[model samples]
Target: MATSRTGLDEEFIGRLETSLDIYGIRQDPSLPPLQQTYMTVRAGQDGSAGSARLALPAFKGDKGDPGDGFLWQGDRTSAELAALREALGTDQRNWAYRNSDNNDLWVWIGSRFVISPDAFGAEGPEGPAPILVGGTVTVNGEALDQPLGTRVVGSDGVYSLGVDLPELPKGEPGDQGEPGSIFSSPDITGGPTDGQILVFDNESGKMVWRDGYLGPKVYNVPASAFGDWSSGLTGTRHIITAITIPAQPYRYRLDFDGSVEVSSILGQTVDVQVRADDPDTGAMVGVAYGNMEATGWVNQRFHAYSPDPFTPDTTGIRVGVVEPGVEQTLHVVAVKSAGLAAAWRVAGNGRSSLRVKLERMP
Candidate 1:
């Protein structure tokens, strides 16, 4: 009743013998005698010699010489590989690599770097052309004069084929808008008078026309107006001249330019002041001071005004504000400081005239 090697009996015997030996059945002998007998009978029926070995433990062989195969030095760039090659000259066994710039791998084959072909696979079949669902062509919103090709997302939220759009036509003319307000518009209240300018009125929130140029206004005081002050006039203040500033919406800057002949003892000083007062309330708005220090009959040019008039809450003179239709007055006054009993006088002549500059501020 021996079964040939060609049959399932032989195959079953071979597999069972391998499993028994792998489970250490031969060394341990833990199986019952009935099962052991059954295994022996099956092997005999399959015509396999009972003396044949199944899964014997492999014997350890002697260690061989170091391999002549390529040694993986580690990943390196092209420059690094070149340096390494120069340091550790070409041996057939050295290997180093860097990822290729393209989708391949660069390997150092000891002598020089070469691109490996293992990174690429066989060419795949061509894929079907992307189905274009739909798209839109727009103009007037932006200038796309040249034909543009772009991928568009369909309503289904998937990106389809790229759509090539031709140069779009110009959009139809839009409805005419209402005309905008000009200088003659009724929104601007006031004159079309000569030498008038358009200015915004914050109180009325409208544009207004006012007489005069928008630049600084200059006022020159005649030399005859600056009368001479005789000697022995110490501890006294004399009025030089008064300037009237017309009512306006903005604050004003007052600057002064003048010269005076000081007849005084050495080291004595004469001080001058420019003061602004509200004509209606008589309230002192601001004041600026200047001085001249000299000996007998010394003519000195003086620029008398606050260092910075536009700054508010400052220690010195500040910008002056005039109410609408109410004029402001600026007075130039000179004072001789008390000193030695020596008599002195500040004389004003043709060169002693004052020039006052008024600038409009926002």
Candidate 2:
């Protein structure tokens, strides 16, 4: 070694240092030559030619076609590539493309997406729809929050704001929509009972009844006869008053009261009774009775119910008192009924009064 740097050595060493960017190299040199090749020059002497095998990089074949509407944009960053892939997978309506360097991967969307004036005004699909950039839309001289993407439709050319419109002032309600059909008393049938109110049923379109008054009916019986019973009286039972009950079968609740003044008849037992009897047969229908020891005055209150669906006597009802046999003046005071007609005796000498009230349970 004369310490001379040979051309081969110089060239070989120089080639190794310089970076070379190669593409489209054959993977298998053993097979027939492809559209690529490898180049070299002879190096050794002495009738024995030597060769220096060029170390080749990993073979990479030609890139396949990028397919329709797409071009290879070189290598892409993971984030950019991921975003592109995501946009593609998310919605087919999304149109994404890139420049040659695969940077700033831009996404394109159809006109029907988001709110835009151009999309709103798009009448046909033949032309490239308008693009949405920084800008708001206004309609009818009022700026819109956002342009409505929906196709504007209607003969009058009214455009939808596509946003919540401010609530409008409510208009004055149109005069009371005429009045509902009037209902009259005569319109109802089966004459409503006393104290029964009328009501209109909207569903049935008819007049109906709520109910008749349910309170107890009171009848006043004025005293017609009042006097102390003399010992010589003909009978033990003295009729104080009588009320006429209609022959109709009606349930009745009879309430009565009577007061009698007795003098010097202490410890004497006196009886008072409200009796309903048939004036025709002199038979009793129903009776409520009470008794009290004679003193200065005896007050009695009695109540009775006729048999269920009780029918009153055909003639009338009689309220009377059973006198105590002795020398005592029995001044009959008052008798009252809650469910029968008024009946009483006006005694000039004594206080006699009876009141009856009649109620129909049926």
Candidate 3:
């Protein structure tokens, strides 16, 4: 018998010596048709015919030296990352301190302050399992440690303090449009009461009010719910003042109708002192009076007489609808003083103007 043989040696095999590994071969026909081949004495095959498959079980690798770190030109590690958290073992009210525990359990991690939640457990003999709030690891690698400076080291990595955050502060105490708490009452004769919002008429603006006889709540009865601002004839006075503490405004259009001769006493000019008549009581609430004398002006005094009676406030002031028969006029006059007999000399027949302001409350 003629022998067709191939020799096998340690040089012919690598990892295969392990009995734990098993591999096999496939046909070269599995490869593209035209090809060159080599002889494998270990598998005892003519390489021209098939493919060899390699397999292995998993294992750990040998350690190697890691390289140097990154650069931010010339910034400190913390500076490179802008900011990092720091925990204080105890509450010291310091800007950099973050109370880590109720027991003043804190650590100065790096830069910013932080606070931790109640972290207590029986994972170890006495202490609880460490939490992974960044920068640290547990004694047994069971968890991450409370990150205080440099708990983590790496290649261009980030640092985290990982303390618990508190919730945010509340908003301004205004209308919260709550369910039963929000109501709209067209039935309202006055302002909207609690829960009910009354969008008043004769006004062109909207006033929002939340429940509470107590306010801060204001009504623009002349703008939105009630009157039209665009048209010169909304038939209602655009009450120009805020329903606020000062001259809480309410508008009216009074017409005396049919001309009557001006009363001589009424026509005569009198020294005028102006006031903001309080609506609550028809008493004079002086806002500004013309001071014929005084210097170093801090506040302005009334100097010119309005040809028409007018109110004072914001944008639309001195300008609004005046209803006929429902609005009247007010007058202001200023003069020099005289004698008891010549009272006309003190507050003379000299009148500057009649300020016919419409007072509408029909």
Candidate 4:
């Protein structure tokens, strides 16, 4: 073992360590520190290259290939509102996309790149993900108008979603229809002293009656469209009377309480009506037949005529007059059907009085 004194020359040692296949490479010690590759020294006289050098290049790997260009991930990382912008070459304009879940950006990969979700998004280490811009989420093409978290439980045709969401509200039915009308007769001091003149509404506005006392009706009646007054139609001795409107006006259908109807006053049959006022001139219009009648009075009976086809036409009411000696007997009176058109009263452009009788039967 002859040892020559080569005073630990730093330069000479550097070249030796840089050469491939050296014992000092793998162990990584300072024999001649000039590290660029990981090396291994082969020691065997029988081998082809007696002292083989295994050169393994070593350099810090880049912060990962900016990603395989295209990235796929699960839920987005951060909030969508705070997503970073990606500079994807010249096509930067198309890079316009609001953060879906959260982390959404363009990663740099080799010579080319792909649009992918942000690293922080889902599985940040895995790479990019699909950016869900906007999608169609509907049930059988029906739009989702309900608020989020609606308790929707329906399988095919069987629905069973009991609402449980905090925001979703319970469904409610529509408001009840205007109350069915309840009317009475009016007290007049004129006309046939024995005839009964009744008025009321049958849910809708159709007033009618007969000449004799009647009872409750169950079935609707069938009548003609003839608009002829029952001229001389006696009622306990009331007849021969005329009906006319104080003026002509384009009055509309009747309105009760707070409800309004669109059905025209003219029906398929006779459009019987009363005097309607003329809005422009306060004049009288053509005669429209009255729709109701009252007939029947053994006593001062109180009946409720729910505007029926015929019988029991009056409600808690009756048509009778007081005869001094005839046990205060009575006769039909002369009163026409009063409509809520433009003329229930002479008072213009204001609420007027309608004829609703509230009699005290004896």
Candidate 5:
């Protein structure tokens, strides 16, 4: 390289450093200082050749013919005015509906505003909501009976004009029915006696009176005869006593005592039986048997009865015994009859006898 003594090269390098610093070039290490161009012009002229300057031209000319207008905008014609009038009429008649006399106003939404009934002379394009004032109002031709600020209720089914309605009056009661039938009392032919009471007899369909006994009557008969004997009677029923009853519907029972004496050496058999007969015919009605076996005096009791509801041939009982060769006598000691409503002695000695009783068993 050749050296210069004039300093022009130094000056040129200084100017380049200054330009890089102004452009923030070194911090952007990947690029060199940017390239640029310059123009030469005289101050106060806009590069135009004429008298005009660079200042924005005074907003000239009346906004250069203000441009087009909206959808329904144009010069009005008779047909357009007629259509508008028809629209206003339809809105008044349908949307903002009112009766023919225009006494009331309604807002059907989609209609122009109207003055409220209570505003200043009630005049402005009144808005959608209506304010009520003192007025006559009718719904479905039935006039309301209420005043302003009072809630109006519609007719429930009955129709009425504006007059207040009153409640209806009540009705009177009806008359009574006639008396039922009654029969005459019959004559007292064989009237009720002293202790009798009146009763209705359904079988005869009549009222009558009678004395009544309600249930079967019972009878108790105790022993009225008793005796003891020691005679040796064998192999036969010796008659010791008897009791008699009348022929009728009766239940007969006999209770008695009998025994046999026996030797200590031999086994002996003694038998006792009851004999029932018809006293008038001497024919037997029934019989019951019993026995005893022992070495000494073996004593026993015997109770007997005829079949239930028995009408034993004029009924009578005979107590007898058999001594089977043991040198002993069978004794009939006590006897009694329990039956239908009667008691008496029938037959036997002072040593052996019977008592009778009669019960109303039926």
Candidate 6:
């Protein structure tokens, strides 16, 4: 019985092989209905092969149930569509068709109608430039009208705005601020007194108040007081004019302008001196000198000045110390030169003048 079963199995295998030879495998057809069917073989958990049935349908299954459809709101104008959306409420399935003249298709999506393929219309012609009308400006509820013919022209518009604003009502005065320092500073010493001026003190590196002006003082010698002098003999000195300077620390400059007349052609020269004299002692404290050469008959114009600044000796005389209203006198004098066989004279009438300039040095 086993031998017979073996013979039957071999015979069945031979018949299966013969059938495959008779109908060989061909390429899959392009059409879905005529395509060859394949059964999927999956590996089981035990590593054994597992087969699944390949069910190929002779035709497609019956169609599915239809979904909710969009109710056509019809082709309407924008105003009409707005009215229809208001009437129909938020029915999202509702839709409307619109031609190019009326825009695109729109669907009502609960809140509003949204257009499909949202596109803009053709651009229209540009409108005329806007004209800005003139108006008044108000400040604090007070109106100020625009001035006549005052127009503000802008790039796109013209306006007439009032340039002047209405004056506001006066407000209450504010509290006064703290007093500021006029001359009271760290760099300045001593309080300001009446008629006293500020002067920088080098020793203390501060500004101090001085009794007199800090600037230069000028004194002009009176022309009427100048006297003419003539000396036939040499070594004769004559006073021309005098200038009085106030009691103060000063550097003096003496200037003399006069004409020298040489009566004798043999006269060589005449000496001119600016001498600072102590009024109390009649003693000359400082002297600066120059000379004029002889020019016969014709009066030779001469100008003389102090070679250096003259500082009065404040420590010498009682008048030198500034307290008792001390004063210093500067005298302009002319002397005939020694060893000259001539007569020389300085004419004081309208040809002689002297000026004294005093400056504060300390």
For this target, which candidate reaches the highest lDDT against the unseen true structure? Answer: 1
- What TM-scores do the predictions have? 0.36, 0.31, 0.15, 0.16, 0.22, 0.35
Residues 202-221 of candidate 6: C-alpha lDDT, one tens digit per residue: 99998898765555566666
Model 5 ranges with Cα > 4 A deviation: 1-226, 231-235, 246-267, 278-291, 306-359
**Candidate 1 weakest lDDT stretch, 10 residues:** 32-41
Q: Using TM-score, rank the candidates from best to worst.
A: 1, 6, 2, 5, 4, 3
Error of 4 at 139 (Å): 21
Residue 16 miss distance in model 2 (angstroms): 99
lDDT of 5 at 242: 51
Per-residue lDDT for 210-271 in model 1, tens only? 76446777787677776777546344656666777677655555556666555667655555
Cand. 2 Cα-lDDT: 0.40
**After superposition, which runs of candidate 3 have C-alpha atoms over 4 Å from their true positions?**
1-270, 274-300, 303-328, 337-362
Using TM-score as the measure, the top candidate is: 1
Cα distance off (Å), candidate 5, residue 289: 5.6
Against the reference, the lDDT scores of all candidates come to 0.56, 0.40, 0.29, 0.28, 0.34, 0.53
Q: Arrange candidates by lDDT, highest first: which order?
A: 1, 6, 2, 5, 3, 4
Give the per-residue lDDT of model 3 (tens digit) for 1-362: 33333663323322221122344334353343332333333323333333443443333355558733321122123332234333322332332322322322222333443333332332444444334543433444443334333233323234344344233234378976756523354333444432344444445444444332222322121212111112121111112122222232343332211110111122222232322233322222222232333222112222322335555432344343332233222222222221122122111122222222234321
Residue 103 error, candidate 5, Å:
96
Candidate 4 regions with alpha-carbon error over 4 angstroms: 1-15, 19-37, 40-88, 93-111, 114-175, 179-362
What RMSD does model 1 have?
21.8
lDDT of 5: 0.34
Which residue pairs show backbone clashes in model 5? 114-126, 119-122, 339-358, 339-359, 340-358, 340-359, 341-358, 341-359, 342-358, 343-356
